[model samples]
Target: MILSAPSKSADAPIPSFDQIPCPILVTDSAGVVQSLNQDLLLLIGSDKERWLTKSMELMFPMASRIFLHTHVWPMIFRDGQVREIRLQLLDSGGNSLPVFVNCQKTSQEGIDRFTWVLFVTIERSRFEQALLESRQRTENISTALTKSEAFIRGVFEATSEGIMVTDSDATIISVNPAFAKLTGYSQEEVIGQNARILKSDRHDADFFLATFEILQKNKIWNGEVWSQRKDGSIFLGQLSISAICDQNDVVLQYVVLCSDITERWDREQLIHQMALHDGLTGLPNRTLLMERLGQIIAKSQRDSRQIALMFLDLDGFKKVNDTLGHSIGDEVLKTVATRLSSLLRNTDTVARLGGDEFVLLLDNPENSEAMAQIGARVISIMNEPMQFDNAEAHIGVSIGIAVFKDRTSSPEALLKRADEAMYAAKAAGKNVYRFAE
Candidate 1:
């Protein structure tokens, strides 16, 4: 049999082809019309007789006619098939349709051995509307994603505190500029390197192990720590580390949040110093002196050691203040404080108990001789000349010493005895030291 089927007029082999939904037409080898589908009649907005009055090219423009006669028919004849051909079809409304057309040729026994047919995949009317909708949706999604990326980048760059991201091995993956400036490390020097490069050597290996163990177990850790900079300056910081993880809780990387507390800590220390010591003389005030003396008495009671308590008043201090103005007298007091500090051993406490009255905590004294020598040393240092404001000033200390054999719960009683001896020294002589009975 010839490789052809019956035409639409004689009931074609494919039933769906007979009820073709798209515009279809068949013609013989010489191009006379043999059959047409209902779609073809409706598409041209004309019935069979109207189409028969014109050649197929009369239905198309001149350029499309040349394309159909030259390229389209030869390819179908060579391949015995045409698939999904995209082309423009002219409608009776004089509007063009963007469409995909498919055609096939088969031999018919009585019709010059060939049948040519055409199909329209898309309706000529609604094609532009569908394409416009598709393009609009694509544009909306692209714009939204672009805005989201810009917002995220701005937030990452604008944060105040230092932030760092590191991998599982503690190698830094990304660090913001604040982190670089805080640690004195450049981005190039830090990236792809272990963050432990900033390790202050303050934390030992055990400390690291404990820290990571907590992070692994709890997924987070927050506390204070000592860390060093690239230049080896040690500083304190409040640090927090959180481990980033996958869905199964396998550690991916770490995010470190840190704040430099060094300046705050220094301020706290200055406040503490101001509260415990006199400002101008840099000598322990009574509050701190009493605390030290109490501890010393408690320790001496436990160890059966003797402790000395001395009260000293600067002689002729009021004369200096009255003659040279109170400012020069304050300078002389500071000079005397410094001299006493250099002469006293580290085991003792020297305090300025307001004005020119001072107290000394003599720790671990042996006997009356040890007390006498300690007493003599302090008096000699105080008797030396002190220079203040380019002028010579001389002063003497009348000191009274008392030994505490056990924990003296009564600071009042100790002070009373020391004061009594101090008055006795003033009465006995101006530059002498005496011990309390």
Candidate 2:
């Protein structure tokens, strides 16, 4: 009976080997399948009895199929020990699935030598798919972080305003190129240092202490102040500072944005000069001169003081202009203005009321004699000839003096009286001074 189990190693098929849960195949040393379990029918999708008896090589025609015949067969045939291996098994449709297989030889008395068992791997396939998806998500997150960092770097490198990041303790951590250019400090010199290294000392200790105390309570500050540049040149700046905070409401860092306003200050001063002074002769113009005269009139009315207003006109200026052009007239007028201005007190004001006409505002004059003395000094200076571009030009003055008593009420009326006296002086010949009634 055992004679039917063992044979020329190929003819006899193992009996009752077809009912196990794991698929099993019994083959001889020649790699021919002499028998297979019932599970092999499900694994390979084949119910044909002849397939169970076919060679194991016939089930797998892959290039690495030699594993079953070479390493597996030799080990089982020589040592009688089971060998474990990892490989793929081809199904009836030629789709391959990975499996772990074990092969061994049992002494069947007359049975074939090598038998192998294969277990299907359903859970391992799902686990491997999950691992691949996890790795793909991790790679995508890493790429996004890299792109965000590159974009932030470009913003820091390209911005015009100096940018710096400091911790809550005021330690400099990172800075941009504009910060280095603005502060005259290099990155190597500033990083990891306290931010006070850039302090300009423009603000006093108490000023800064009060400012930061307010900021610590409110976390923001915006204002204008003076600052020192790289070469210690003082400049005005508009500054804005803010604090960045975390989710827990703790401050993370401080951000400061500053803009230079020195040019704006210069322009403001220029506008003031243009408004208050004459552009040509650098003297007070009509508008500011009137303001000063109004102030003097008010003061004289209150204090019971004597004041004087003088209106001066160049004699024969029209004839001079007709002969030598307005350029020489301007030089003559400028020369006359300079001569008359030198005779006034510091409290007095000299102004050009426009073309060949000027006004002198004398504050608290002691008497009409003093006013007449000032008028005489002006007349004497005007007698001296002025040097022009081509020749010496002589001019004379007609000065009208108006004396204000304790009750002089209006600057406009005083100016009108002075002008009338000046015209009377002009009527009196050319080089003379007269007082208004």
Candidate 3:
């Protein structure tokens, strides 16, 4: 009937403390080590005999020892526990290791003692610093992007050329002030509208389709286009369209820039006409006549057909210019050109070389008889009287015809042959036709 009966049951297993992975310690109230696990002895490169009965400050750096005395120990005594307290420890080789420590204060045998668990944190500190630096770098990039967008917006607002931005579907998203001025529409009126709002009837469906096809392939289209203003007035502008793509090369937007170029284009047309046509009668001058002659000669050679090149000079043009003044002479010349052009086929061309000399081109002439009939009709038309203001003026024409069969004759040689034949007609009584042999 004694306690010896309870002890006779079985042998209970002893718990193994060395199996714990991290460094663990037992310290008295004064932070003097009473016991340490084998893991801590191995971690600090020290034996248990060297640490027993020694102050735990032996394992801490000078700064961490001061912090332990000043902050960690006081907090542990007051709170009875401390958690995740960061500190540094000195190893046997004097290398400092960052660590996180957790401690619990307990009463054993009426005395205060502490159980400490420590974790190495050098690699974790490095990882935390890397995360902080990554966050800072992302912030810096965001700031830079904001500044870049501000710069782009300033340029968009200040540029002189009209700019319009659209989505991939060609719906307008933004318009600059210059674009509003050019199109007579305010920004509020244009946003969300399709670019077709500015479309003029000048461009057909085929034209737009071809243009868009080229733009899709090349990502740019620059040309003169007819556009309409908000007031329904049509105008010409030099349009430049560009595609905007994302990092993956997907089309995100379209940008249209335009400048009014109508006046400049009209001036260019005027200069072109002045260069190729006579100033008085508005007939094709020598430059244009030669170009037409070369093209017709090529066509006649390809078709194995004939083309007639006629050279004519007014019979008494110099007499009229001297007697009735050059003003009336100009009127007579205009009348002669009109009559000659009216009587010929639409495929024919009549051009003035200068002064009172004229040339005509007729493609696909039938025969000599047909040629003679045309030549006689031109002479008869020229012989008619022309009313020049108050008085009437009469002028006759002497014609020379040069027939081109193939590409064998050059344009200059052909014109020269016609010139020589014209003089022959003037020699043969001054009012008839002569054919170049």
lDDT agreement with native, every candidate: 0.77, 0.79, 0.88
lDDT value, residue 277 of candidate 2 = 90
Candidate 1 local lDDT, residue 420: 85
Candidate 2's residue-wise lDDT over 166-252, tens digit each? 899889888788777777778788889887766677788987788688677788878876776657777776767778888886889
All predictions: root-mean-square deviation over Cα? 8.2, 9.8, 5.6
Report the error of model 3 at residue 184, Å.
3.3
Q: Candidate 3's error at 351, in angstroms?
A: 1.4
Best by lDDT: 3
Per-residue lDDT tens digits of candidate 3, residues 1-437? Answer: 11123444369443355656778888988999988887778778867888999999889999999999999999998999999999997877888888999999988579888988889888998998899999999999999989999998998999989999999999999999999999999999999999999999999999899889988888899998999999999889899999998887678999999999888988999999999999999989999999988898887766777788899999999988888998888889889888988988888888999989999988788987898898898899888888867878888999998887547888888898888889999999988999998
> Which candidate do you rate higher for lDDT, 1 or 3?
3
lDDT of 1 by residue, 1-437 (tens): 12243576654464454465666666655445656667666666677876663566555666666876787768777886567665666877976555565665665554442343445545543656677777788788788878988886676566766788999889999887777878888888899998888888778899888998999999999987788888899888788999999999999999998879999989999999999999989999998988888777777667877778889998989988888888889888888888778877898988999989988888887788987887788778877777665677777888888777436446667877887888888888866778898
- Sort the candidates on TM-score, descending order: 3, 1, 2
Q: How many Å off is the CA of 132 in candidate 3? A: 2.8
TM-score of each: 0.62, 0.55, 0.77
